[model samples]
Target chain A: MRSDKQSRTPMGLKIAAGLGLAFLHLPLLLIFLYAFTTEDKSYQFPPPGLTLKWFAVTWNRPDVWEALGLSVRVASISTVVALVLGTLCAAAVSQTRFFGRETISLLVILPIALPGIITGISLRSAFNLAEIPFSFWTIVLGHATFCVVVVYNNAVARFRRVSGSLIEASMDLGADGFQTFRHVILPNIGTALLAGGMLAFALSFDEVIVTTFTAGQQATLPIWMLEELVRPRQRPVTNVVAMVVVLVTFLPILAAYYLTRDGDQISGQGK
Target chain B: MPHAVTFQKVSRHFGSVRAVDAVDLEVEAGEFFAMLGPSGSGKTTCLRLIAGFEQPTSGHIEIFGETAEGVPPYRRNVNTVFQDYALFPHLNVADNVAYGQMIRGVGKAERLRDAEAALEMVKLPGYGARKPGELSGGQRQRVALARALVNKPKVLLLDEPLGALDLKLREQMQEELKTLQKALGITFVFVTHDQGEALSMADRIAVFNHGKIMQTGTPEEIYRRPKTRFVADFVGSSNVLSPAFTRRLGGPAEWASLRPEDIRIGAEGGHEARVTGSSFLGNATRLTLDMAGEKLTVLLPAGSAVPAPGASVRFSWEPSALHLMGTET
Candidate 1:
C-alpha cells in the first residue's frame, strides 16, 4: 500500500524537496567559494582570482590558535557539566510524581526555547548584579545553560523509552538501587547521552550571541571571527575561519545523527 | 511446611483505586503456588507486594517468617521474572545473569562460572555472548529466567512469564518451568490470567477477583468444586444453570454443579429440551439446549448423531458426577 502511494507522489513535492535542499546548502556553498577568493573586503559572486594564500595566512595566525583552543576548552567543559546536570535533572523529573514538576520542567526547557539574545542579556544582567567577574568560567556557564536543555531533552526521551519493569526486574534479581541504575538504566540510555553531549558540544563550539555577552575580553573562535569580519585586513581569512567552523560543527552533527539513528528503531518490537 | 511468603491483611491503594485491598495469603515452601485472575484483578500487585516492589498501605508482609515491612527488593531473598522478560538490551546474556552476583561483590571468576552454569540450566549454554535483542522471544525469556534464577533466591516469583509466547511455546514453557521448579524445590509463586496454565503447573491455585481470593485449593478441587460463581466462570467453561430450588446434597451451602462432559444427551429419565446450537470439537460435539427458559450446554461424544436445531432432546448425568458447590446467589 505504501508502494502504491510512493509511485504516485506529486511532481510538486519532488520540486519542493529539490528547492528546499538548494535553499539550505546554497549559502554554505557560497561561503566555501568565497573563502578561497583573492578579494580582501568585497562580497562578490565571481572573484577575479582564487588563491590558497588566505588559507595559509589563517592557519599561521597565533590569535586564531588561541581562540580555537579556548573554544575547545569551553565547549568540552560545558558539555561535561551539562551532561551530568542534565542527566540528573532528567532522571529526577522523569521518575517522580511531585508538586511543581511540570513547572520545573518548563523552566528547565525555557532557556533553549527563548531567543538567544534574551538569554545573553539575562545572564549579563545577572552577572552584573552579582558582581561576578566575567571570564572563561562565565563563558562556560553561559554555554552550559542552553547545552543542558539539549542533554536534558535527549536523556528524558531515553528515560521515558526505558520500561519500568526493567528496573523492577533488576531489583528483583538482588541488585541494589545503584547497581540497577548502573547495569540496567545506564546501558539503555548511554547512546542518547552521547548523542546529546555531541550536539551540545557542537552548539557551544560556534555559538556567537551568548558567548559575546559572557566573554568580556576573552576571544572565543566565533568572537575572533566576528572581530576579523569587522576589520579590513585579510578579510578572506575570516571566510576561511568560517569554513573551519562549519567543519568543526558539521562532524559532531553527523556523529549525533549516527548515534541516534538506531535509537528510533528501538521502540517497536521486532518480529 | 512453613510459609515461605505471607501477606497478612495487606492493602495497597493508588489514590482511590484499591489495587490490592486487605488481602491475606500464604505461599508454602517448596510448593508451586499460582495466583490466577483477570487483568486489573490485583494478582500482579499481590506478587509485587511479595517481591518488595510495592509496600502495602496497611498491613504487614512476612517472608520466611521475617517481617518485610521496610526491606527493599534487593535485600529480599526473592527474584521475579517479569511478564515482558525485562532483559538488559545492552548486556550480553552472561553479563545480564551475572549482574546480581557482581553487585553482591562476588569475584569475577566466580560470577562468570555461576552465570555459565545458570545459562546451562536454561539450556542456552552457548547463548551467553548474544544480546537480548539478538535472541528469539523464547531465548530471551530463558535468558531472563537465568538472570533471575542465578541469584538462587529462596523464593522465585513469576508474573505472567509465558504471557508473551504463542500457544505452543507457552504450553512447552509451562511444562519446562514446572519441571525446573520441581528439580530445584524452591518456592515458586506464579501469577497468570490463564487458568489452564495455573492449574497445570501449580500445587495449589489461588483464584483471585476484585482484590480478594475467591478460593484456594488444589487444581482438581478448584476445578471440580468452585465455591463461588466467579471461580466457576473463571476456572473453565461452565453451563451455569439456575435451578428452580436446589436441595442441599451434603455439607451446608452445597449444591450440584453439572459438568458438561458428565451430562449425557439421551440417558434414561433425562430432562427434555430443544437443541439450540451444536459445535464440533474433535473429541466431543458440544450441544446447546434451551431448558426452562435457560440455555444449557452439554458435551456429547464425537461420532454421535447431533440433533437438528429446534429438535427435542433429553439430557442426564449421574448424581455422583455432580460437583457440590457453595450456595448460589
Candidate 2:
C-alpha cells in the first residue's frame, strides 16, 4: 500500500512540473513572437504580419555588433578571473579551521546578497577617488565582484560535500599534496566548477546596473539594450538582440542544471 | 622482529577533552595488530596520529625505526583504508588503483600492470571500468583496498573498514582481509569498535577505554584473563560475581569473573543458588540464577532441562575457571 502511494506521488509531481515549465517559457515565447512580427511601433498581440526583417537589420548594425563583442569580452574576462579567485578562496576556506573563518566567508559572499546598485555606487566612488578611467576593465571588475560569489558558493558546497577522509586516504596512499589535489579533489569538484563558471558567465553577460556605473564610453549588450529601450530607433533590432542574449544565457543555465543534478549523488556515495 | 610502528606516551587533546590520552604501543613487523575501542575511545585518533593526519600533544611516534615527528602522511610509507572505504567517486576502479603508483612516478605500463594485479588479488579482475558508485558496498571496499595495496606501503591502516557493511558481508570481508594480510606479509594496524572483529582477526589486540589503553594481549588472554574490570566486561560476556568470602577458594579476593559457559548446573557444587529465569538459546539455555542475594547468569547446554523459576539449584565450576581480581591492587 505504501509503495503504491509512493509511486503515485512522482506522477502528480510530474504534472505540476509540466505546468510550471509552461508558465516560465510562455513569456519568452511571447518575446520571440514579437521579434518576428513586422509591426515596429507597438507590442500588441496577434500582429497583422510576421517577417525576418529584424534579424537582418540587427546583423547589419555595426553598433549592435560592437556592443555584442564588448559584452562577450567583459563576460569572458570576468568569468575567468572570478573562477580562479573563487576556486582559490573556496579551497582555502573549506578544509582549514582558523579564527574569523565565518567572517571571511561572509565577506566573500556579501556582494551577491547586497543590492546591485550599492555595489555599483561603491565601485563608482572607488574608481572616482582613484581617478581611474572607466572602460572594459572597470566593467569586468564590477561584474567579477558579484560573479565571484556565485562561483565561490558552488565550489565551497562541492568542497564540503567531498569527504575529508578521501583526501586523507589519497595522501596515505603515497600521493603528495599536489598529486592528491590534482588527481582526487579536482576531478571530484570538476562539475561544480564548470557549472559555477557557466552561471557566472551568464550573469556577467547580462549585467546592467553595475556596468552602467563602471562603463564610461564602451557599452555592453545589457547597457546597449537599456539605451535602445529608452530612445527607440530600429527597435525591432533590439528585440532580435534580446532574443539572442536570452538563448545564449538560457543554454548555459540548462547545462549548469544538468551538471549539478548528479553532483550530490557522486559525493554522497562515499559518505 | 623489529617494531614497524611505535607510539610512546602519545596524547591528543581537542581543546579541554583528551581524545587520545598518553597511549604507548608497539606494532611489530608483519604483525596484524588491532586497536579495539568503542566510539569516543580514541582508536581512530591513534590511527590518524600514526598516519600523520594529526600531531600528538606530547611524546614520539616512530614508523619503521624512524621518528615520525615532522613527516606528513604522504611521506610516511603507510596507506589507509578509511571507515567509509573512501573510494574515489570520479575515477573508475582502474584509475583509482593507479593513483598511488602515478604519484610515485612509476612507469605507465608498470603502474597499469600492478593495478590490474592488485584488483585481481582483491577478486575483482574485470571491474576496472566500473565507477565506485556502480559497485556494491563490499566491492567498493575491495577497490579501496586495491587502491591502497597497489602502492605496497610498509604498513596498512584500516579504520573500521568493514563497519558500513551488513553482518554477513562484514564477516566475509574479515576473513578475506586476514588472508590478504598474511599473503602480503605487510604490517597492519586495524582499528575497530567490534570486539568480535578484533578477536577474530588480530594477532594482538589493544583494548582502549576513555582514550587510554586498558589492556593489550592475545584474544585468549584478553577473554580469559582480562586485567581490568573494563577489559573483562568489554571483551566478552562474563557474569561478574561479588562473592562474599566464605573462606576464599584460592586466595582472599573481593571480586571474581566467571564465564557463563564455565558454570555448570544440576550438580552438587560450590555455590548455592535459586534459578530465577531460563532462556532457551539455540545451542545453550541461558539461566539467570540468584546466588547469595546476587544475580548470576549461567549458560547450560540445550539438552539439559531448565529449572523452574523459583526452584533452588546448585552451581559449581572448576577451581581454575574462576578469574580472581585483587580487591585493592
Candidate 3:
C-alpha cells in the first residue's frame, strides 16, 4: 500500500528540476552537436548541416597534436604532483593538531575558493617577482596549486570518515607505524585518493585560465583554441578538437564520479 | 609473580578535564580484570593508557615489570578488541585475522593457517572468505576477537568489545568470553560500564568514578562490602542508610549500605515501617518501605505474603548484614 505522498510527482517540482538540469547541461550538449556540424564559419542554431568531416580535419592538424601533447603532459605531471602533496597534507591536517592547523588548512584550500582569474593573475605576478620564466614547469606548478586543493578536499573527508580506533587497533596488534598505515589507513583511503587524483587530472587537462598566464610559448589545447578562435582558422577544426577535449576530460570525471558514489561506505561498516 | 599491568599515580588530562586522574592500580597476570564505571569515569582512559592510545599526564605504568613509559603500542605485547570491534573493512575475515602475522613478515600460507585456528577458537571457523560486512554483529565481534587472539599477546585489552551487541547477544558473549579467558590463561583487561557484566565475567572488579577508582576487589567482596557510598549505590540497588540513621543504629561509619536481600520483613522483626510500594520481580518480590521517613528496599521471596501499600510492616537485619562506608559529595 502506498501513502498519498509516496507516489505523486508534483508538476512544479518536475518542471523546475528539468529547467535546472537544462540550464546547467544544455551548453555542453550544444558543444557536442557543433562538433559534428558542417558549418565552418558561423554557428547555426540547428547546426544547419551535420558531417563527419571535422573528425578527419582534426586528425591531420600538427598544431592540434602539439597543443594536445602539451596539455596531456602538463595535466599528467600536475596530477601526480598533486596526489603526493595533497595526500600528505591531508594526513598531517587530519591526524595531528598543532598551532595554526586550521589556518594551514584554510590556506591550502584558498586557491580553489578564490576565482580562477585571481589565482592566475597572482601566480603570474609571483612568477614575475621571482623572475621565474613562464614555461612548461611554470604551467604545471600553477595547475598543481588548485589540483592539490581538489585532492585535499577528497582525501581529508575520507580520512575523517575512517575510524581512529582501527589505527589504534592495528598498532595494538603489534603493527608498527608504517605497517599500520600500509595494512589499515591505505586501504581505507585508497578509493578516495583515486577519485581525488582522477578529478584533479580532469581539472588540469582542461585548465585554461591559469595556463594562459603561466604558458609563455607553450600552446596547450585550450591556448591553441583561443588562438584559433581569434585568427579564425577553419573554425570547425577547433570545434572538432573541442570534441576530443570533451571525451578526454569526460572519462576521468566519469571514473571519479563512480569511485566516490559509494566511497562513503567502508567494506565492514554497512552491514 | 609479577603483575600483568600496573599504573602508579597515573593521570591523563585533556586540556582542563582530567580524563584519568592520579590513581594507582595493578592487575595480576592471567587474571580477568574488569574496570567498571559510568561514562566519564576514566575507566576507558585507563584502558587507552594500557593500550598506548593515550599517555599519562604524570606518574608511571609498567607492563609485566617493564616500564611502559616510552614504548609504543606495537612494541608492547598487548592486543585489543576495540569497543566497535575495529575490524579492517577492506579485508575479508581470513585476511583481517592474518594481519598481525603479515606485519611480522610471516608467509601467507602460515598466517592463514593461524588465522583459521584463531577463528576456530572464537567458534567462527570456516567463515574466513566472507567479508566483515557480510557477518552479523555477533559474528563480526568474534572476528575481532579472533584477529586480536591470533597475535597471542601476553595480555588482551578489550574496551567494551561487546558494547555494540544486542542485549541477548551481549549476555551470550559474556559467558563465552569468561570460558575463553579461563581456557587461554592470558591476562584479560575488560572495561565496561555495566556492573552486572563486570560481576558475571571478571575475576576481580575495579569500580571507578570521577577518574578515580572507588573500590577494587573480587566481585563478591565488591557486592558484599562496598567501601564507599558511591560503590554501594553504583554497584547495585542498595538501601543506603543516612548518616544520622547510621549513627543512631550504632554503626561505626558515617553511612551504612545494605542489600535488599539482607533485610528481614516479618512481624517478629524489631524495625517498623510503612509499605509504600510492592512489585513482583519473577523470582523475588521487592517492597519499598518508608521507615522513619527514609525509604528502604526489602526483597521478599516470590511466594511470601504480598505487602499492600500503606500497611505497617516490621523489618530487621542482622548487625553483620550492614556494610559501613565513608561519606561522599
Top DockQ: which candidate number? 3
Per residue, candidate 3 scores C-alpha lDDT tens digits across B1-329 of 88999999999999999988888999999999999999999999998899888889999999999999888998888998988888788788999999889888899999999999999999998999988888998999999999988998898999988888999999999999999999999999999999999999999999999999988999999999988888888888788887888776667647889899988888874678899999889999999998777899899988889879999988888888998776654
* Candidate lDDT values, in order: 0.86, 0.87, 0.88
The C-alpha local distance difference test score for the whole of candidate 3 amounts to: 0.88
Model 3, residue A109: distance off in Å is: 4.5
Please name the candidate that would achieve the greatest lDDT relative to the true structure.
Answer: 3
What ranges in model 2 sit over 4 Å off?
Answer: A1-66, A88-113, A122-138, A216-218, A232-240, A247-271, B241-251
Q: Sort by TM-score, best first: what order?
A: 3, 2, 1
TM-score of each: 0.84, 0.85, 0.87
Winner on DockQ (2 vs 3)? 3
- B69-134 per-residue lDDT for model 2 (tens digits): 889999988899988888888877888899888888888788888889999999999898778878
Scored against the true structure, residue B182 in model 2 reaches a CA lDDT of 97
Residue-level lDDT tens digits of model 2 in A65-171: 99999999999999999999999899889988889999999999999998999999999999999999998899999999999999999899989877788898888
Instruction: Output DockQ, candidate 2.
Output: 0.54
lDDT by residue for model 1 over A39-145, one digit each (tens)? 88888769888999988998898898999999999999999999999999998898877899999999999999999999999999999999999999999999999
For model 1 chain B, give the 10-residue run with minimal summed lDDT. Answer: B243-252
